[model samples]
Target: MDTAPARDSAPPRTTAADARRGAPASRRPVLPYLLIAPTVLALAVVLGYPLAGLLLLSFQDMTRRELFSGAAPPWAGADNYRTVLTDGFFWEVLARTLLFTLVCVGVTMALAVPVALLMRRVDPWLRAVMAGVLVAVWAMPVMVAASVFRWLSDADDGVLNWLLGLLPGVDLDKHNWFYDPWQGFAVIAGVVVWGALPFAVLTLEAALTQVPRELAEAAVLDGANARQLFRHVTLPVIRPALVLVTALLAIGCTGVFNEIWLLRGGRPESDYYLLGVYSFIESFAVNRYSTGAAISVITVLLLLGGAVVYVRRLRALGEIE
Candidate 1:
């Protein structure tokens, strides 16, 4: 007992050394912000500066002369916004935009989900080939897609008409696809959906692959069929991906200018005019710089709202998990 007390009286050398060793490790200087600096700087230059300038211009009644001649433009208050709201044609254009976005998004998601599911079940080699095709579609230049489709939809010697001619009892000469508003809209929506589907498929397919195999196996063992498994298990697991892809698709669809511009044969007065087309026409054609700026600001706000809703949904889904 006496010896034990003597040993306890000795200084705890190893403990002191251990505490000394841990002090440096625990007080390690953190510089995580350095890694994210480049991303923050890029966003500031690319998105932030332009966005700020656009918002400021939206409130000014700036003509082309005022913009280019360095003269200060008078304030417009809500005048530009009022013009957009009060004009019957503006309301009509807005309605068309909403309808087109909803229809195209609905169709794209409807087609893409089933296709993604099928691709998941396919052999790896075949899946790779399918992904390659989608990548090719995605990699096509937006302008190039529009140009090719324009050539196909031409009234003379167009491939679409050429193919229609081969169908039994098909009337080839009745419709000018780009002439009527509804016809033009159909073509536009179709082209937009095709362009957007590749991204949707790619995103959802990756999500499908992330689904745990054991969950699927358990479902199968419990007499769950393919449809049941997807409905109950797979969908819940991939809901976040679906939300993200939907947001991306919506953002892309909301700013559909190039395809509509080309499909309208670059007509300024085409009924397919949305905010995107309106902004371009205002800036370059009509020289309504303030109006163009306002439209751009609105489009950006709409996209941001959609993105926020998407992220919130994703967060809520994650919490339930």
Candidate 2:
């Protein structure tokens, strides 16, 4: 018959979404991975290789000889680690580093939180001024700040000593702040906190801006005092930022070296050794590259552990998805 043959039924076409749904569960969107591929590759080339090399170097008995001669260092296995771990001095330095970190982080948070809260309550112009000042401080070079601090706490003719000398019965002129490790660390901690404050304060302030006015007013309507309002409402809103800043501060403090190094004229005494300083001294000063690499590896492990804990905390708080 001349009638057209019945056309065969064609398969339904699928859209991208449909294809995604029909795909195996293990298959994810490749676009995201593709977009990130360049970044991952760059990091692998820059940071990953160095980190891997450092790890490998830690297991070798590298020294000045191998470094200058470009010779392969002897395989040391765990000998370098054992030597560092067995040293009482290393333990002392670790303890000092931890203690210094605690103090710096604690003081920074204490000062920053209050300043941030103050900013929230102040006039907009005042807040702007404060923010400008903080930005300026943050923008200042670390080297310049450290130099200024060193000059201030100089053993002779220091502005700090001069100011203290102004106080009746206080004779701090020509005082050697570095003579006492405790006092020296106090100055170092001060420098750290000063440098850290701007970031913490600005971060907290930004977080504060996100606090719902409705919630704050609601709390006030519920007869909540300022402290209670903060405890129940404000703190919850800012808690994520607070935790982040505190974690960063802790990590930064643990790795402090520049301030001490500059203040002590590049030859910091045993009393002034933090983990970073200790690593540098072992590697460069003592010419024990393997030992330094081991120390650095340990420090990295500790930092990684802290970061894991921080991530878990964020997840627990529902701050991270």
Q: How many residue pairs clash in all the candidates, one count each?
A: 0, 0
- Pick out the ten consecutive residues of candidate 1 with the lowest summed lDDT: 1-10
Would you estimate the TM-scores of all the predictions? Answer: 0.85, 0.89
Q: Which stretches of candidate 2 lie over 4 Å from their true place?
A: 1-28
> Which pairs clash (backbone N, Cα, C closer than 3 Å) in model 2?
none
Residues 1-321 of candidate 2 have per-residue lDDT tens digits of 599999999998878557545667577578978999999999999989999999999999987788889999999999999999999999999999999999899999999999999999999999999999999999987888888889889978789999989999999967999999999998888888889999999999999999999999998998999999999999999999988998898888888988899878899999899999999999999889999999999999998888998898887777765
- Worst ten-residue run, lDDT, model 2? 16-25
Query: What value does the lDDT take at residue 199 in candidate 1?
Result: 93
lDDT of 1 by residue, 1-321 (tens): 345443446664656446545547556555657888899999999989989988888889998678679998999998887776677876677677777888889999999999999898899999999999999998998788888887777778678877887899987764577777787787788789889999999999999988999999999999999899989999998888888887888888888888888776688465778879988888779888888888788788878888878877876775322
Give me the displacement of residue 13 in model 1, in angstroms.
30
Local distance difference test, each candidate: 0.83, 0.92
Best by TM-score: 2
Stretches > 4 Å off in candidate 1: 1-33, 165-169, 319-321
